[model samples]
Target: MWPPRRSGGGDVKHCYARGHRDSGLVSGSSHVRSDMGDIGFKLKVLRRIGIIQPTSPARGLKAAKALRTWGPGFPSGVAATAARFPQQTAIHDDAGDITWGELKADIDRYTQALKDRGVGPGVSVAVLQRNHRYLVMTLVAVMQAGGRLLLLNTMASSSQLTELTKREGAELAVIDSEFLEVAKNIPRESIVLAWADDDAPDDLPTVASISADMPSDPHDKPEKSGQIIIFTSGTTGLPKGARREEPKDLKPLLAYFGAIPYRGNSTVVLAAPLFHSWGLINFGFGLSTAPTYVLRRKFSPEQVLKDIETYRARVLVVVPLMIQRLVDASSEAIEKRDVSSLEITASSGSALAGDLANHFMDLFTDSVYNFYGATETGWVTIASPEDLRAAPGTAGRPPWRTTVKILDENGKELPQGETGVIHVGNDMPFGGYTDGNSKSFADGLMHTGDLGYFDEDGRLFVAGRDDDMIISGGENVFPRELEDALIEHPAISDVVVTGVDDPDWGQALAAYVVVKDGQEIDADGVIAHAREHVARFAVPRKVTFLDELPRNPTGKVMKRELPDPA
Candidate 1:
């Protein structure tokens, strides 16, 4: 939604909302706030974002009734968006585009098709595909049909996929056409194709094909909303399934709106894989605001710039790695495109290094939002551009309705400027691991499994993972501080510090450095750079130069893949 236009010769599309206004309050959220200021805050946010407008009262009633039938979640949100703004563009993928009305109809048909195939309530369904139109449809339709959703990483191997399918008890496996060969190993009788190309097998069963021949089946609303499971990054161990409970209030929505200035009915280019928590969260926002999402099955730095120019997008959801690639491609390809339409580059899913954030903002617009969180707990802290400029590498402050604490090993609170464990309490709390494992907590706050300290200005700075801390010669060395120092070198582009066993010191530092292109640097220079910036004990005893550090799908360094110290 845009500002009101003058009475001139220009066409303006009006973005409006109805549901909360139907409930008499502008926020349509059920809250027991006694303070009038608290009530007024949400009302202003809704109105500024075009969610509260002068519209028909009956339309608001219909929007409210649509959510009542589907229950609250992505399914209900999409249904409500369709009820209020059916003509609004909801999705724009590589194949084509679809309106809210068309998307809702397709989802409803597919929901019936799924229910007929015994994908009833509590049944588990696994989805494996890149970001695409059908993939989004199948995910929402499964939720509407009352099936527990297991989102699979597209980069997983045949063995991992097979193991995950059997381990999660996913009765059905919906795969893209390219991965049909890998699907053979999933060991599921109800294997369905999410999408297929021209050369796909003739007997392939797709969601479209299945829905085309399916009968109209009417069913009552589900007694309970289905659970959504996002697997952990298998860096530490085997991937564990983590489910999120159904939201109790509009706190999550209000919290996001309060921090990130998201507009209604805008265009967003999602470069991040939709299977991950970060991408899926943005997808949820797109549904609520009815943004025209531009999705590509694969990610390319150059292609992403092109998409931004083509779509004139307002927001871009991605991991930090994509920003690095964009910067790397700046001279070669990205500089040619007019990508100034981007207003917010909301990065999550992996660590957003301080240097990378500033470099990106310098090259592009000053719109980098460094989101610090995990798959278990969403958006712990968001560093705005102002926060990043004021204090680089700082995770900024917690958003609304969020609590963050730095606690010592004994579960006691740590004062500011003291590094300790990070515990958080927010609307997007974890629903425990599916394997019955859960994160440790203290005083109603979930332990984030991270080490960090708060600055004098209340900014959070994550030192590193708790396990990544090294005790070399009885001196504690945090790799993040050293890595941040080394990345500032003019010749170095990236670096990662880790602990290595040493006979001299109980444990030693090993730094993997990625030198900038056309620059020459060896172990001596790298060691000198480290020694100048960090303590002698924190300096790397061994330096290994690499073209690039290996990373997982979500841009996390796969430390296990690093070679043994030479």
Candidate 2:
């Protein structure tokens, strides 16, 4: 029954069968076996893709032990990895490399220092820093000391930070030296530790100095797992903290481990900000896999390519904006590096447009994977290279043990090929927002606020956000389709399509385009090009040229910031 209950007791058949019920498709025990067979086939595909080594009894035993010891928390996992792979290279940053043994010692020292300052259970600690070895170590130390972590977005304004920190009841703020002004409103004596070793402002102290003489032996483990408060991207409104509880079942993550090509003893270049979910999750996976994570304080496309060659990195973790930047970099600059060592380029954080996907794959081979999910929903789908080749812009099918459905405004499931709101069901839904508000939930599925449809083959394709859809002349239009078509133009470098007020059409399509250097294209030419690829109603009625589109740190377009048409 139910394929012998592989990792979790939740019936896989029941999960996926719910989607088929809308279409009146029959599902039974045979479907469960087919799902299990797919997983087994994926395991073999992973080996062929170089994501996992060929199985051996010793290797299996070691992996099983690692999984059992990690327990879904970074503090305990780091400690376990140090004891097992003491000499393995754990981190490689601008400063130098550090082994698991060295990292553990550093974490222990920081834990001791934080404990002396009364940082323990129920204590909220805010961290505002760039990506570096110090920031990574501080996260582990704070949790190890039994303190909750409030990950601050570096791009937030000082007023925004002050408001969020107050809302989250943060008592201590560990900040980078460059961002000292952002924490000015906080009390100086409340343990404002500098994340980097740079000279602190007159009122602050560096974390390095505080832990310099601390003993690195026998750190105390937290009585319970510490909560991690990650904020929403805040594009639509004020950011809210999405509190994460300690994972009880790791079964949901097994889908990602199967679909993504992360291997042990490999080099992973983390270009995405560590403050975001995509980066933080990969960082946690690195702890147990013992991969050498290459950290950078800032992201630069040129630097990313060079790091791949310099470190001979196997995986490059990034967002869609970073991918666009990599492709935008001069061909001469990109061609000089020997980046053949990279096997998998994992992209998430925002929608990966079809043209951008094809361009990246053409340059780097068929190694690009687009992951679709939200901060609250975790991962919903993964588009493999084959999926992209087939559907051009599909978000791909659901991973193992996950269910997805498209429902209309009436909350009724829509048939295939019909656009509706996307709802996803998984074993691990978010615990809830810290502000006592929850997203729309129905039948145990979390509403994603995105509108999309499923093709006959069951592959999902995301339209735009539900609110972003424009009702022009009674024909529903999504900006994503128009944007994807516009990006294929050779002269256009980047583009964002928005719905602007139009009395004649209810809401007309307006496009903001960034033309490539040394290329000139007028609004009429762009409109003419778009009409050839997209429907007439989907074509933009007006086009505005700009140097670049405004985006959040996670690479999502700040649509609210875009200028309205005159």
Best by TM-score: 1
lDDT top scorer = 1
Locate the minimum summed-lDDT window of 10 residues in model 2: 1-10
Q: Which regions of candidate 2 fall more than 4 Å away from where they truly are?
A: 1-30, 34-70, 197-199
Would you list the C-alpha lDDT of every candidate in the order shown?
A: 0.77, 0.76
Residue ranges of candidate 1 with Cα displaced over 4 Å: 1-34, 214-219
TM-scores of the models, in the given order?
A: 0.91, 0.89
Q: What is the lDDT of residue 485 in candidate 2?
A: 82
Tens digit per residue, CA lDDT, model 2, 287-382 = 646578898888988899999999899899999999999988889888998899988888899888756887888887677778888878887778
How far is 74's C-alpha from truth in model 2 (Å)? 0.6
For candidate 1, write residues 189-244 as lDDT tens digits. 57888878788887767889888865433335677677889988887556789987
Candidate 2 global Cα RMSD: 6.8
